[model samples]
Target chain A: MSGIQDFVVLTLVKAAPLIYAALAGVVCERAGILNIALEGQLTIGAFTAVAVSFATGNPVIGLLAGVVAGALVGLLLGVAATRFGVDQIVAGTGINLLALGGAAFGLTVVFGQPGASAEVSALGVPGERGLIVGAFVAALLLHLALYRTPWGLRTRASGENPRAVRSAGIDPRNVRLIATMLGGALAGLGGVYLSLGELDLYSDGMTAGRGFIALAAVIFGRWTPFGATGAALGFGALAALQFVLQRSGVPSELMQALPYLAALAALTGIAGRARAPQADGVPYTE
Target chain B: MIRGLAIGLALALFAAAAMLLAGANPLLGFWALFRGALGGVPQISETLVQTTALLFPSLAVAFAFRAGLFNIGAEGQLVIGGLVAGVIGARLETSGLIAIPLLLIAGSAGGAAWGAIAGVLRARFGGSEVIATLMLNIVAALLANYLVVGPLHSPGVAGPETAELPHSSWLPALLPGTRLTVALLIALALAFVLRWVFARTVFGYELRAVGDAPEAARRAGINLAKTAFVTMALSGAMAGLGGATIVTGVLHRFNVSLSPGYGFIAIAVALVGDLDPLRIIIASFAFGILQSGALSMQALAHVPKDVVSFVEGLAIVALAARRFVAGRKQMTALAPE
Candidate 1:
């Protein structure tokens, strides 16, 4: 019984960050900006959280700083896509490279070393539990806000038909920019959970493609807030299973690959013929 | 051309700012970078080797972009190709003449198969190639790690790499002592061939029509699904062949860390070259200088070598505008009145 309880706890702990990132994807794609920069946002958030924590010795402030940093990176993507008319995928790829390179550079500058930073103040276990609960709360709130609010209608309408939003006297670009920022903030908090809630220090590649995994969760969830959270929890359970089955002679690499493999399988219509938002990844031009 | 020059200047400025932030002299960093990349015969040869390594994937990326498909899984395809080549080369005992072509073909086939997975998904299921390719990249890495380190582990090898290929399987050297080999010539010939194909082939015209105006191409009776599958497979073959060359010519074995994001960087190269196969060779050389010079820049200038990638990332964002404008122009030109 205790083992079952522990597994449940571990699943929530693992799923927290993925839930945040998947939510980020849901919001951005729903608003017509395919935020391929979610990985970059996560990287920046994790790095900034650690750097600020190391500087001020306050984990909470680091948390806030991380969210703001992520939002700024999201803003960069929004401006480039909406204002400069840059290809979103290209811009997202660029941002991923930039965030990775910038963080590696930052490690040398801030920590006076490469590869990792020294152990710093962390949010501890209670904070971690709080975040796990907050993830569920966030999902519920997103579901409500997306389906029940006027802003949600505008955001969804923008994704389905941005020209219609424009005809209604609201610039869809602003709507997209705002959605990206909100999504970025959520993803930033996810990063904070990884660095602060689970670990005490920052290491290069610590995020370890979790950002990409979150992308899979988004698709599996069919681009809905509650649905994405549920998919994230399933992935989290798989991660927990990996830990349990590590000593059972099963290769961990294969285990680590299950989500990606599932995503590939999903592309074959095994998951469903669920359609994405019409204007998703399509840049709206004036 | 002017846009390329401006982007170069901007990258230089960004590099300088990064140096300043790192407490290094920007001038010293620049000097070290150029000196390391072009100082002597050895340095230049090393730069060319880097150039050769980058060329295959850059051209592969340009190929798919011309077909309006983003083949982001070049990294994965390259790994699978190298893995197949390395595994086959390790065991095959034959004359160099026979072994080289066989191994290269195997590598290309491996990459094409990997690429065809995404192609099938897009062609049959009407799925997004972006997500499929992205997922495949991770799967490729994991599969390579499993194969090399587990069942296919090379005897007497301590690391997660295959046994070195027999000497007969090795690609003949172009420069006796340097790592540069006939692979450079092969890559150059491929670029010329690709240029001709794009300019003069009926298939090329069909591909361009699909990329520039998909609806119109469909109306013209072009098979969009078949074209997507074929283009992706061919793109993957180019990247796979690049991997095979690396295994046979450079490393003589496959290691899981075969590419350091070359596939992703190839996107920048393709875009910078304006998706022109011939011009990608030039772009590859420019990026190659950075790849070879970064180590020296770190050692001598105390600047982080990551500055190169950072600047490359900035360059991608800045240059992406060009692709957008070009794509828009093509669409407008082909739009029905």
Candidate 2:
């Protein structure tokens, strides 16, 4: 009983970051943007959170800094995709690469270290139970915002038929831009959770492939908030299982691949069924 | 082409500014980068070697870009190919003449197989090749790590690598006393061949049509699934060949650091080259200079090597934005008054 409870708790904690990221994906993708820059946004957010927290000795300030940094990146992506008509995938790839190199540069420049930063103040509660709880609350709030609010209708409409949204007197481009910024903020919080909650330090590439995994969850969930959250939990369970089975002497490297493998399996297994939003990747030309 | 050059030049200037801020003389750093990449015979040979390693993957990326498929899995495909080549190179005891071709074929086959997984998923299941390929890359990396640290671990060797290949399996140097090997020649030949294929071949025409308009190509009786499969396989094979060359021509043993993100950099090369095979040759060499010079710049000028990556990423984003600007103009021109 204790073992099962521990597994459940660990799974929830592990899923917290992914839950935030996948929710971010749901927001942008639902608003007709691809948001492939999640990885880069996560990286920048993680670095900012740790750096600020280390300097200020306040985890809350660090978290807010991460959110702002992520939102800025998201806004840049939004402007590029909407105003300049850059292909979102290419733009996202460039941002990811830039974030990686930029983070390394920051490590050397700000912290005077290479690879990883020194430990910073973590949140008071152990194991980041607060973040996990906050993720669930955020998921619920996002679901309501996406389903019940007038803004939600406009966002979905912009994704499905921007012309209709524009005809209805709402600027679909602005909606998309705002949604993308929100998405970035959420992904930033996810990064903050990883750095301040999960590990309490920033390591180069510490997010590993969680950003991409959230992307898979977005697809697997068929662009629904709750669906994405559920998929994230499923992925999180697989991650927890890897830890549980680590003592069985299976090569940890192989086990390390579980979440990605599960994502691939989920994608392939559910392919041709989960239809994305109509104008998901289309650049809005004025 | 002109615009890409302008963007590259602009990014270089920006990077120089960054170097100045980092406490290095931008002019001296630029000069050092130039000399390290192109000055002496040895430097030129190393540049060619780096170009050889980059060319195949750039071409691989270019091939897929032509087909409108983003093959981000080139990193994984290259790793799997190298792993196979390392295993085969270590085990095979044939003459160089036989062993070389055999290893190359085996390596390409491994990459093709890895590429085909994403291809198959996309063709049959309608999965996004981008996500599938990205995930597969991680799996390939882990799989390679597992093999090296476990089954293929060399006896008495501390690193997670296979045993060194026999001397007979090593690709002979094209320039004696230098790292330059026949791989450069092979890469050059393959570039021309790919360019010709894109220009003259029926399959190439069909693939382009499919990429340009899948629905129209389907109406014209092109099998979309088969084309997707073929394009991805061929792309993967090219990246695989690159991995094999790295093993036979340079490393002679497989290690995790065999590729310092060459596969990812190949995306920038392909995009900057505008997905043109011939142009990719020039782009490959340009990036090859940066890759080789970065280390020397770091060592001599105190400029961090990550600056090259920053420039590469900047170039890609700027180039992509340039495309958007051009696209906006086209849209305006086509819009009715």
Candidate 3:
């Protein structure tokens, strides 16, 4: 029981970033935007957060920097997809490539390293109860904001039938931009949790495809915040179990593949039913 | 064509800028990079051989893209194809004449089966092929790792790699004094065949129609389900062939690190190629050159080879960003009907 409890604890901690990222996707997608840039945003955010924390020796500062970095990318994507009427998917892909390239370039320009940023000053902040609690509270709050507010109603309306809402005299494009930027901030927080809270270092490809899995969670959870977070936790549990089970006679390589398989199962199991925002993958106007 | 040339020019400028920023003379770096990639007979040979790997996988991706499916699982297909071919080629040393073709067939069959799994799910269950294939890639990768580590640990070999393949199973060399094998010719021939099938067949026409508009394709009495299955199966077969050739032709042994995101890069190649087979051959070589040049760039500039990744990233970002600027809907509307 203790061992199980320990695994659960570790799993929830690791699950924090995934939960944030999935909900981030959910937020943007709820506003009728598919945020495929989540991966790139997370990667750049992690890189920046780690870099800032290293430079400033403050985790809070790093967190803020991460959010800012993510929001910058979000702003570009939002403008491209909304104001410019670009295909949101392609714009998102651009964001990914840009972020990936930007991070790599930054690494080279700043530290002259390839795989990792210079050993940064580590942040011990949110190392325990604060981190897990932060995710749950966020899930609850985002769920509330998404369902229980008039603004939320407008946002949902924008996603479902934006043309109708646009005729109602509100700019759906503005709403989408806000939604995407907020999602970016949340995703940036997830990145901070990785580089600052857990590992205290930044490495190349450190998100390790978690952001894509978070997209899968967004699908698995059918675009709901809590559901997405739940799915994220499920993935995190499998990930944690892979670590735990590796010690119990399983080959390390086999364990390495289990999280991906579990993610696939989760994606396929719920994909047919993972309804998107009616306007998802479509550029919004007005 | 003009746009592509402009893109190449922009990328050249970007590469030069990157080189200068890395504290190396941009001219010197470009000289080394270009010379390394396309300088001589030897260099060109290496570039083409690498292009052989990139072309097959990219074509695999481009074929699936034509069906509105993104198969990021080429890595898995490549590994499984290689593993089956390698294991069979080395271990099942029965008759060379029989075994060589059999290994290729078996390897491709393994890749097709793996690819078809995602196709089946997408076709019948409406599962996202992207997720399914990508996950399967990791699964296949680890499976290869397990095979190398446990069962195929190469007859007293300490590391996780298979033993040398039987000489008879090896692919015939395409050139003297180079590792270039008959696989290049085979890949080129298949690409030509793919082009013919795409241009001439009812199947290919329907594939285009389905990709253009799925519901419209169905309205035209085209069997949407059939198209999905066949296209995915064929796409998987291409990637499978990619894997098999590497085993019997290139590596001749299943190594776990046999690929480094070759599958994802292939997606970029497919897109940049505009999903045309002839264009894919060229696009594959372009990327092959980038990869080949990257190593030399690292050695000359003391910059890591990942700098090439930045350039690749810049190119992808620019291409996708072009959609955001020139914009797809605008161009579609402007085109003369």
Candidate 4:
């Protein structure tokens, strides 16, 4: 039926951004850096994509710029955690605040407005469909790269035992820094999807905590690329169901709260007792 | 002391650069900021009110940090606290003497319950409090929105807020015609009490031991789970008390937007204060100036007040380096002394 097809299509569309962000989370946490600034990266990416598109009238170029901006933000977190030995949690929180505040400030500076930017050139419906497909492709590639490559082994070693990675003559900090940058790029693309792919404008809080939901997905999937992708798809389905159920009698707030509540329940080990990386958030100080 | 001065200078420079980007004169923005925060008695009183609102959450954050737990749910706790106070205060018709304490207790209990959820998760399941608290914060907001607008919506109210409390229940203002109230004194007294508790109490010793060296504390037979639960509950209580005061003394009703991310800002405050309760009062005051003066800076200097948050975020990153150094210094200080 068209209804079932529409629901499935809607689910993928909703899941695309979350899938990208969860993949980002999977990469970073596996590399031993807990990237709490995913929200900030998403915000900066969405904002920069809109700003660049507004100036250049090229959505593709804006997409590239957005990814670069996100990588820079991730580099900020990586340097703070790896080089400065700053607490990763604290630095992540700081970066979130900075990215959010900076984007709002950027809105005033670039668009001559606060709260949102004017409508800009955006990726067309075809581009959006491509992005949705690209999300699944990204998940597949990450799974292959993580499980099959030597680089993946090193990255996993860095998270499990950075000292061991160092014994193998690789600097775990560099590994973490690279992972974070890649993760940031993935998250940025997710933001670009939200701004350029889904909508033609950037508004404050438009990302609407999808980044955090991706965090939940990372956990629900037990930090595997494919697992996280699947979890993201599940959350996406929930969101689509929310839209469909809106006409019914269920409270929208309660529906909106289900993912968070599920996350909280997951904390109680309801999702199974799968363990995180030993050095997931530990700073690699030498 | 020199490091403190350097950080201050760096913040000033950052603010100036932001103003330049915003096409505003840095010097004029700075002047407006100060003048708005301290130009007159009224302005100063407003600054103190902001300071008072910030102090409670800052203290709560510091308390949890001292126990080696990240209580990022203070915002949620504060909201639940205020919601409980507002809902109860709306229905009660009693003397101020009886109503005030009862409402505040209810607020604290609400916050403690909210906090205890994360506490139990960590203490019993060995879960990360960070994730638990973060999820709870969003849930708290969604829950508050639902309660205020749906089932508990008070008649005659036009927006998503509870009914106003009776005049008798309103906190007696410290300065007549100003929002400042005895809540300031209460927060200040709490600071001193916490200072003493940290300095002298057995529980404080246990808490510091857990924070400074958790494995060693476990070896020393301290119950880590119990300590985690108690610390989180107490921390939530402090934040809840702050929420109650805002409802009783400042807003006179519970509005979901009563705090502009004060809970998150309190992390920066707690860090800048070096996790010391007494010093957080000073940090709260410093940030209070930013909170109160931002509006004037926006109105007069054409600088987006968001620059304050940008600077605060930068300050958090900059100050994180100092906390690392300070932590090392404490480690050395504890060496066989």
Selected candidate, larger DockQ, 1 vs 2? 1
Model 1: per-residue Cα lDDT over B1-337, one tens digit each: 8877987998899889999999999999999999999999888988988888889988888888888777878988988999999999999999999999999999999999999998888777777777888888889889998998999998899888899999999999998898899999988988999999889999999888778777788789988888889988999998999999999999999988988888888888988888898888999999999999999999999999988888888888888873533432233223122
Clashing pairs in 4: none
* Cα lDDT of model 4 by residue, A25-45, tens digit: 999999998888899899989
Candidate 3 lDDT, tens digit per residue, B87-131?
777677766688778988988888888898887767766555666
Candidate 2 per-residue lDDT, tens place, A1-286, comes to: 9999999988998899999999999999999888888888899899999999989999989989999999988898888778776777777777788778878767766687779999999775663878888898999999999899999999999888888998888889999999989999999999999998888899998988888889988988889989999999988898898889888978888767876776677656644556778777666666
List model 3 lDDT by residue over A1-286, tens digit each: 8998999988898789999899889889888887878888888778888888877888778878988887877777777777766556545655665577667767777676777787676557545356567888899999999999977888888788888888899998998898888888888888878887777778877887777778878877888998998888987887888777766877777666656666566545543545567765556544
- What would you estimate as the lDDT of candidate 2? 0.84
Report the lDDT tens digits of candidate 1 across residue range A1-286: 9999999989998999999999999999999887877888888899999999999999999999999999998898888888888888888888888889998999998898999999999999998889899999999999998999999999999989999999999999999999989998999889889988899888888888888899899889998999899999999999999999989999999889999988888877797776778788888878
Ranking by TM-score: 1, 4, 2, 3
Could you say which candidate leads in DockQ? 1
After superposition on all C-alphas, the RMSD of every candidate to the true structure, in Å, is 2.4, 3.9, 4.3, 3.1
TM-score of chain A of each: 0.98, 0.95, 0.92, 0.98
Residue-level lDDT for B228 in candidate 4: 84
Clash pairs (backbone) in predicted model 2: none
Decoy 3 TM-score against native? 0.89
Query: Candidate 4 local accuracy as lDDT?
Result: 0.88
lDDT per residue as tens, model 4, B195-298: 99899999999988877777677779988888888988988888888899999999999998888888888888988898888889999999999999998998
Each model's DockQ score? 0.66, 0.51, 0.42, 0.63
Residue runs of model 4 more than 4 Å from their true location after superposition: B322-337
Which residues of candidate 3, in runs, are more than 4 Å off? A1-5, A75-105, A125-129, A170-174, A251-259, A266-273, A283-286, B94-96, B151-153, B320-337
